[model samples]
Target: MGSIDPPPIKLPSIKLDTTLAELYKRASPKTAGLRLGLASCGVTSAVDLTPDFQRNSRYPYQDQALIKVPRRQLTLDNTNLRKSIAKKYLSLIPQRDAFIAGAMPVILFNLGQSPKQIEHDRREAETTISVLDCAQRPDLIFCPGPIKIPLQPEQDHGHGIDKLDYKVVLDGLEANQDRLTRDLETHWFLNSKAALARSGLPTPRSEILETEGVPPEDPESCCRVCAAAASSSSSPGSAAELPLFPAKCTGPRGRWLAAQKDRILSAARARPVPFVFKTQQAFGGAGTWLVRTAEQKSALLAELAGDDSDNDDDDGVLGKLLAQVTSSNAHLGPATVLLSELVGADGDGKTVVGDYGLTFVVTDRDDEADGGAAHFLAASEQNTDGSNAWIGSTISYPRQEQLRRKFEGLMRQTAAWLARYGYIGPVGVDVLEVKKSGSGQGETEFFIVDLNARISGSMSLPLLRGHFVGRGLTCASSVSIVAKGGRAGFIQRWRKPFEEGRMLILSWYEDPEAGESIAEVVIGGENEERLQELVQRVRENIEEVTL
Candidate 1:
């Protein structure tokens, strides 16, 4: 089996003026200054930095500046100018210690380079930062998103900056974005038909097309169907059918309506027994269902019909399904409907293995963020195809030694690949872990599944924590998700259990101090007994925490 390495250990140094120095002198010696990227994307995405600043603002030194560089204009000249302006702003802020660059991917991608070219630009960009001042260099440089590179030691050795020290914030579900995208390119699955060809992985067979009229209802109506089905089945095809994974129909509503329905029905019938039905555009598990029998399918159809009545819609079941497929419309484009085969559990009760979502951050620094350091945040776990059950999660602050090595290796591989495409910054990779059947221990396998090209919720926690701490920080605790809404009431009702650690729930939305909106439950400390107590409390009051 291939081995995964942990990240390296390195921390950015914060420069402090008299006031900040005095403050640090009085506090823990381990405390370090942290610069936050308070850009709009960072703030709305909940990249936490407020707490950290609050805790450290009183330090002997502090620097503040709003660095605004256009996303579309990341030329070397613009980058240098931004850096110069940032330096000037720092000069004015009192007791400033260190610098943290916090530009996001939205801005980065707008630079208009492919994934591959982005790497060369990034290296050049980092070089610019390095040469700015020999006397006082920025201690840490963090991206608002995950770095789209694998972690590799040999390859990273000569870089002027410590790659490990640079951090990419990520959401929990999308940690492996970089790896998946790399795999996609490596495997050549960028478009729909290409994705279908690579079906050995967990992706659905699908297709993509541009049409002026509505989609065709007959299977043979479109050429994509002929191509997709031609390989697997000998059956004669129809014009409306297309062979693809997550098949998409794009055009005016009327032209595609009938064809889209036929495609959805065909997908439903063709799916294996005990499958799931999901609308393409839904998020956070919405518009997803498990269908074991025709009865359940009918029930779902009835529900869709009911929904249609409220809006005076004519499409009924098909329409609801189509709406779900197009929910991510703004981002994906207009009038597009996607239908994918549902992947489910195997007979052994293990969900069909889909892919693992590995969330990690890449920092410009060559070292890992300190233990319990909240400077970088990420969420990731293995996603199975069948049950959709997640296994092997690493949500809390990473053990620097354990995480860095793995991240570095992965980043090195990913970066090298992306360097060819002009894509840089934070990425989320969806991976599939396939295990051999029988022997109760067949060799386990890993494959890339999908990719998310932005900052994720997994990274938000650490950011928030760091903002609270006002230093480069990481958390040694795990944050558990609970139902949204009424979280405050739930926490208030179960405060005792939480304090006692009987319920080791970390409220993601709860202001640790104010205790509002307990979106997540947190559990910490080295005490096993305390952990257990929290677990029991969670078991007892789960209903309160869940919607």
Candidate 2:
């Protein structure tokens, strides 16, 4: 096992850390001589959802080359920045999404872009227990064959989680009519950032820039971003004709944001340095942006308002797209938006402390009298980029007592809050140890930034590291890795760690045609500094897999 180590930021790769995003996956961590699974999902039926399961992304940034370019040198060219970011973004939809194959034992996924790649991933999952020697999860069910999705034109097939085809989902439900899904409604408010601003919690200060209007008994069902998470048809906020929001902006948040348009437009004009402009629902960092400069604010607002007059060329277009990812169409209506205060960052606005993802399990007995429980599974420090898009997660807290002391209370309160709403499942919260901007720089504050209602991108970090918990290995970190060969080489390269029970390969997606693969891995180490040598060794091993 590996101890949590310094991040591989200097390596030739792109990362945001799962500032890491949300992907609802059920995770079971070892507890008191027993194994308890939260959100116990069984795959009684499989959705040969293989064909149409591509992810829905608004920007045209799906080129891997773009991601390899140094951040400082990156420009908006048709080169390739979008590809890695887009993949990272897709890996983080709010619900059970792109990389659930990693967290859950019973894998349901769309492996890369092609059917051939899907076959590779399917093989990996099928042979996981045998190859890796890890215990098979209780809720294990291997779907039949690697269903080959026939190639089709872009318009004919539906994308992955964000814009899945309702027809496809319902159609695949031919046999397993009884779906085992959680009650997202009960906990939506407590976890959503848009709602967090209104909730009375020990959280960072925030105000709604946009939100849903005429609440639908349950606001989550009507929220454009949340509603639109599963598919365009997931909510009425999404028009049936086109995958767009309603034309008129009627939400009060819209009115509030518009009224403050002048303030927002000139927010960074002078500059004490502004903060984040987050669209209510987004994966990866697509929905999050930092308004640090006037030029950035202009480009952001221009992008949001659908005005290209100020957009220069492909270079300008790429920058605008990366800066603000919510489609103009979504913003055409009252989609949820927030103007969040910065926390956990240095005075100059750089995030020195980085972000942390807190994962908790909320459980309840039907007998209301039996009061429920929320267990703190683990916490991972998120690795992100200048834009704040999350790359991966790491868990290397040597100060065990202090780690639990600081976050447990908040997680307990959060769980209690969710239980009150009669919700049960797993929840992930993103928080930061705030470094006060002004005179109070010495005094730090812990503030909640985002509460993920579903299994988060980094929720698997703890589970993956548990294999080495008893060992002397003191830390662990998860990173999305790209390699020359495919999963075979990945497995071969890290087989020793797998056999040694010191590492885990949670997710693997290989594109054979492209002769490349992307995977999410957890590396164990003695401590952060000592773990660097190990992290680099594996990184190089994985990167040069083909050879």
Candidate 3:
């Protein structure tokens, strides 16, 4: 959080674009029906969630572990071990299911896990949901977890570990596809539509897949399928004319890494040193590196070049890079990196990053256009600790509607672009408005840095706001804190604040047998300042009580 001066210029209010209102109308729950939710953190975020790579590193799960257990007992207790193995992976069940209301019940699904593991994770997720008073919020059931079918010895490859998991889930889905489609809307939502498509499910829209340079459709096989379909006149559009995909509009990647690297070098020569390097494979800033000098960039590149030679299971930036390569294609040189003009401080400037995201649902598909359309659901302001680790999020109307309009336009363009590939589901876009030169007086610039085509940490803030505000609250924000030792019960000490409408424990899960707990609080206040003040008060109270 750097300090920034107020707007250097008077910003004009953006005239409301009918796109949002139209989208809202189209997505009314009356139009949207009950759809099954495929709730898994890793696979949805494009990260491979397997025991080999380990549980999801995203929050709710990232901090979940058995803190005080004896090492020897950990190996003996299969139940506790399964819970520990799948703790973080199960966090999304409640998080995603919270968005569903009405009679629409979701059948939660997960891959690379057993039925016992899924049940354990579901129980853990339900504990937090109960704390949030969301136990009865949505009608939900846990689908039997996917069975792991190991790859044969001859065909075993590093990639088969993930591929096999998808196969098991997809096979189960196909076996019961008739029953599922009959009983539920069966909307397949996960991180990678390409992966989903690989499971024999339909592919969804995703620019990440596009910029990764995966051809929109498999020219050899998929085109043949489309061609045969066209011969039968089964679907719309011609085989010769594929939809014109919009060029990569935002994020760090364009074309191949080789070309992207050349652009980075060019940008470095023109601007300042110490640029930002982000790996295409990382989620939650794990694959991000700060290249401080030419020497550092050279060293980092040298390390990346040796990625193929390294067998070390490191989870740092390099480890994440290698993991992404092994999970993706082998021909991609074992790693890919994106270099961008560092969005850090600008020449002795002091600035605070105004991080924001828009969550929307794709509503319509236009075969003529290269992409599809989406309806805006909510807006969220991300609160980071300045290290890219998300602290929490403030959900409110933007002070500058103009900036929001720009964000909406970008999202619409992105959604339409993704729609080209038949993707329709919840989509989140990450945008940043930086104070030019990192100073209050510096010129301001906003860049769309990342595109999360799946559910994200801040995605649920808007939903929480809708849920709470509808219950007669002024505003709402989601705050998370690690509950260490006595602080897991710190909520009892903050009873006065909860009674005063300063804070509400939306979801609190403290393992009865573990030392570390996670408390996800939905704090309410009359205004943004009051909400922030209440959050601070809660933190101060926790410190005193824990001490």
Candidate 4:
């Protein structure tokens, strides 16, 4: 895509604070070309394209993580997920970006969409305020078309990866000669659960699961549940007579997969909430599902057992899982997924589970000194809405010390693992502190739940929290809200704090006709009390206008 003529809009006067400036310098010691405009990797990353892979999983059932599915569904789901990111989340990228433009001083994004649709979203975002880099006011670039550069000297226009699919964003950037070698390092390892298993860090019992349709010797052999094993030799998985799962393999491999699935299904039946299925390269909490109830387990297991005669009618967790599978008759395999223990819930393991986001910066340096080398920026507790989706984050630099100590060893190990791959950028690891479920909740367990190699979704929380890195005002909060207010009304309502520099607007996406906007904002305060009070007042003010 080509850069659009930036509409003439009022620019915010961004006064760079020395402390905040230090973070930017540290994040990009050599270059200030932090790219936020790259096309994003959505819900799923890889399509198996072939049969079941040789497993590197720790658990037996992990070998069955990849199953054959229809291809038509896979392409459609991929298209929809990418479109949603380009349309909705594209506007929210600049909130933490404008406030903390240190790491990403320049934003580059190619929506690869119709220019009209691209401009439509940009206008709704109030781009000046939404993409405003209050720290440096970074140069903005938006091209809604594919790269014209010589990516593949061998391939023509529509065939180049840049034009074929912008799904893998970095490939397009590198084609333009941006030195992003560090970003490419170890991305595959860090992208999946394999990195965590290999890191030897604290994590839940995780396994890579894969499923083969049937034994090549007996493609017609149907699993007891498969009503269509003999439907067509084109898809043996549809009618494979496998146990515990809808798939089947006749020999030793089949038995191994059966045993694995059996153990997992047994444990799932024994416990209320026992498993979480994590899709590869999924972002913004889109592909994480908690199997918490016996009912949910029953429904999910039934789907796994080849109960697809209903035409994918179920709108539950299993249905979502099917979306990534090959849904067409040709090439019916699903993308590889991860199955892990669902640590802490009510009966379903939703008890006192403390979810934390620990963000740190990795620089290319061989420090033979004391404290772990990577910069552990902020340890923010994630805030989730009623649906348990991440809504915001409450980060505190001063408070992060205790968390660092508690998970110090774990963090160091993680940082070392990332550094080993020559990766030097922002990395965030999600952690969970679980209080024992039964027997008075006396015991505790800590598990590293997620590893984000690149700049994570909530990574901007640090830019706002970094304001008080050394100073005493350490408490920081950032949240996204859908409030009823027109552009003028919304800004005027918070003008006092806006002018006073007490509260910072991260993003504002206006829905003019609906009289509402979804905003992501952060505020710095002297203490947690003041932070809470200010947030309440902001909410009250916004709520008052809503009525």
Candidate 5:
């Protein structure tokens, strides 16, 4: 929130390619093209493109194909899926398509259920990605946001839509759509949170409270209506009413919150252990803190009540934090505080992190799940530190059956919840398994961490291998190739194991400068030793080849 300069405006540069020229010749010289924003955060771009293509069966148009032009550079450590996408584009899209000049075919298909009708009335077609030339106005341009800059006035030389005729799609529509989507997701999370509580799952106890004016000073005044409704539902569970977690909705006010924080701090200190505090609106562990001592809690409250001089810009965020804390019994502390119960480590002295679990997705074709092939992608995983652990390094594959069983149940529930909320894309539910405290029996306790609502890291694993398991591809044979190389020199490495039909090579690269390259090779074969060997060889090769 500090004083920072606004980013400079950028102008678009058209890169004319041969394929685009050919596309211009084939389509009516007067025909217009449609360009959809396929950026990562955009709606249409979130759908899994490969399955969409297989399901739809028809390439919409030979000359007009969907493309994903990333606004970034590619690195040597690209994933196998990305490499495959690049190769596919190089082979499919011709070099002479006129209307599609400079566009990269990162994806060949556009998949998303469209509204019943699209209006084509506007004279100036608008998009987030600027189309430099003003003469060729597309009949309909679909982008995720509103246009910020005006197009240059010019006349078309008989190439497309009449000069000075284009339409603009406002950003308000897309923004509203995204907001609705987030609301729906929040509702789903709420329902799932209730289900976990009812099913005797281990989750942090919480409640929802709605209030008028600023939040009340007394926590007892907060309503428990949402919790009551959830508990009374006719789901399969014990008939006894369960204790509801506190959830509160409130307006903006500093005085009410200052009083409430004092009471919450006293109540929290009365307990044996310190409590964890979080802001309602914050995501990804932001605005969360652990309060362990009265001194620290008092300091936090002082900061909240202190005058705003240097941190005036953070006042809005601080206001939201105060509202959330006072609404319920949650407190606010220093960002560096850590007061949660310490979960024990594994036998090997390593803290056991949660499984980076992902949902196995099998899309329904004709409303039936039978014919659709399942593809697995890794989703976000919850680590011991309450942060998201992605695919490559943070988490290792869960090798124990006990851990896997607990994770599988969590995943099943997660997938069901996602399906209910109209999300057909690849999803994942990350959960952690820690040893139960004071049990002495070494029983593992499971906790639900976070939900990933999109295609995750594991999605590419299965695809890289010939067989798609809906989570990851098995590359046992490919792993063997690396394993064999470990016994020999790095220069004599064999690529044949990865070439095996069963193995999936996630990535492969050879750098000239450092002479070092890395690849994510998955082992799919049944042989454990062979897989181990392949992993060793790959590791060794990476070390030797890299400068």
Candidate 6:
């Protein structure tokens, strides 16, 4: 990182009343037990999900395109993975048995699915609860499985009225309204704005598609505008552009994409270096593409001539390129695309191999309303594919005291800003560190690239922190691996690191016949230095191939 400072923030001009909303507190003498209902993968800015809410949105004001919030939806498979990971977390709670009986059960309101799909969700939930094996038995009132609803028709699947689908979701939610509200005291924590909308209550609001000046709630429009502004202001020493939040743009998809390209290409011409392309709605680094030369850009433009393939993972660079290839294609529209010059830390004239992030929790408690507080959880050095994808995180603990000091005020301000927009829950701000060159002393610059307003892939860090704190140890890092080729005793075969107490396997999901698997590991040590050592050892011992 270069000279240390908080990246510049562009505050929205639209002001609102600062009186804070009250959140459901834990059960107590004066308060009823908070029956928290969970809404997984609610309606997002992207069109892959239902467009009922978007259909009702008041957008595209005066030809100024409204950029909707970015979509971070997970697949049904990842849904199971999340539950499995959460099981390990539930096990980490030392007092799980004591609290289970009295703890209010959480209802996982999921996207509507078919009868068969509903069965799968029910089986997964049952397995999750059974695996926990708590003594008292929490009243985890999940349900008769995820409610089934009709999926939104693809852009090309239908034309006139047949294209609608959100109405089905709304109908389903309305049908279950009475059951959902059987317990008047239930508090709902939703994953998408659409879910919150369907609830018809305003206690917890989502600022996602409701950002000021972004009236349309259209993902393509919102993504392109905000991305263009971010790209222009992302130079090394310039004041950083506003954090990647909603902003407005105008015209159709082609114009928007061209504008973004010109902005990014202008920067490349100025610097003559590689740049990264990003789409707002993709996951697992799937929406990222690296453009190295003008010829490559030309070739990409040429390939767009007749490519109409719409199947396969649209979350990666290939999908993003295809979207661009057919920008005008009604089937694939242009939204949520952005570009930025690749910058990294340079130590002793050499690029270092890491980035850091400050992860914290934001809640809707009344006590914090006086002036929102940044409940600083832990800072972690992020592990990724050298781009936008987040792989894992290692808790840096008290070791980042210096960086922490620089970040304290920034964190508080950011949290407060988010709260102003009605977001209440987990928030992570990713910071990029670029070490100064030839300074002959330690000096670094920091930049904020992304803000995850919801749960992140690295959620395991906070859970690991709780466990380590209870054990009087600090967690070093959490690592995620996608590997192939393992045996029946794969865990045992990888015992050297575990035997050395360098790391512990948290969870693993594999396909034996296909010989492929994915897993997450938690590493630990007494302090930061020791933690780094443990991380290296774990990495060396765990081969990318064969478990």
What is the per-residue lDDT of model 3 for residues 1-547, given as tens digits with 9 covering 90 to 100?
A: 9998533222111111222212323543343333332323322222223333322222111111111122122222235544433333444323433333222333344323667566655664454444333333444445433222122344323222211101101222333444332211122222222322233221211222222333233212434443343354324322211111112212122123334334433443443455665544333434445667777666555444333233322112332333222222333332344444445535434254676766777655433232336656666776655345455567764333454455656667666665655545566666666666635565655555555554555555554444445435565676666566533245456656554544554433445457765555667666777777877876664421100
TM-score of each: 0.42, 0.60, 0.56, 0.64, 0.39, 0.50
Candidate order, TM-score descending: 4, 2, 3, 6, 1, 5
Q: Kindly list the per-residue Cα lDDT of model 5 for residues 1-61, writing each as its tens digit.
A: 7998544323233222222222222322223243221112111111122222221101010
Q: How accurate locally, in lDDT, is each candidate?
A: 0.32, 0.44, 0.41, 0.49, 0.31, 0.38
What clash count goes with each model? 142, 30, 13, 39, 53, 15
In terms of lDDT, the best-performing candidate is: 4
In model 6, which regions exceed 4 Å deviation?
Answer: 1-33, 40-274, 289-334, 341-354, 365-371, 386-388, 400-404, 433-445, 469-473, 483-488, 494-506, 512-516, 526-547
lDDT of 1 by residue, 1-547 (tens): 9996534322223221212112222222332232112111111110112211111110001011111112112222343433322221211110011212322111121111356434533432343234222333332322322332222344323222211211222221133433232232222222222232233433443333222233333334445533444344334332111112222323234335556565555555555555555432222212345667778766655543333243332344344334322222223222232333334344633334434345443222223432211112243443222433221123334443454444444444443343344333344555554554553755544434344333332333332333322332233233333333444356456665443332222222322222222233434333435444554555465422211
Error of 2 at 292 (Å): 2.8
Off by over 4 Å in 5: 1-39, 42-201, 206-274, 290-318, 322-406, 418-423, 437-442, 455-547
- Assess the local accuracy of residue 441 in candidate 1 as a C-alpha lDDT between 0 and 100: 58
| CA RMSD per model (angstroms) | 18.9, 12.2, 16.4, 9.9, 19.6, 16.9
Which of candidates 2 and 5 is the stronger one according to lDDT?
2
Q: Which ten residues in a row have the lowest lDDT in candidate 1?
A: 54-63
**How much is the lDDT of residue 143 in candidate 2?**
28
Tens-digit lDDT string for candidate 4 (259-327): 544554454455445578665544455456677767777765664544544543222233233323332
- Give the C-alpha lDDT of model 5: 0.31
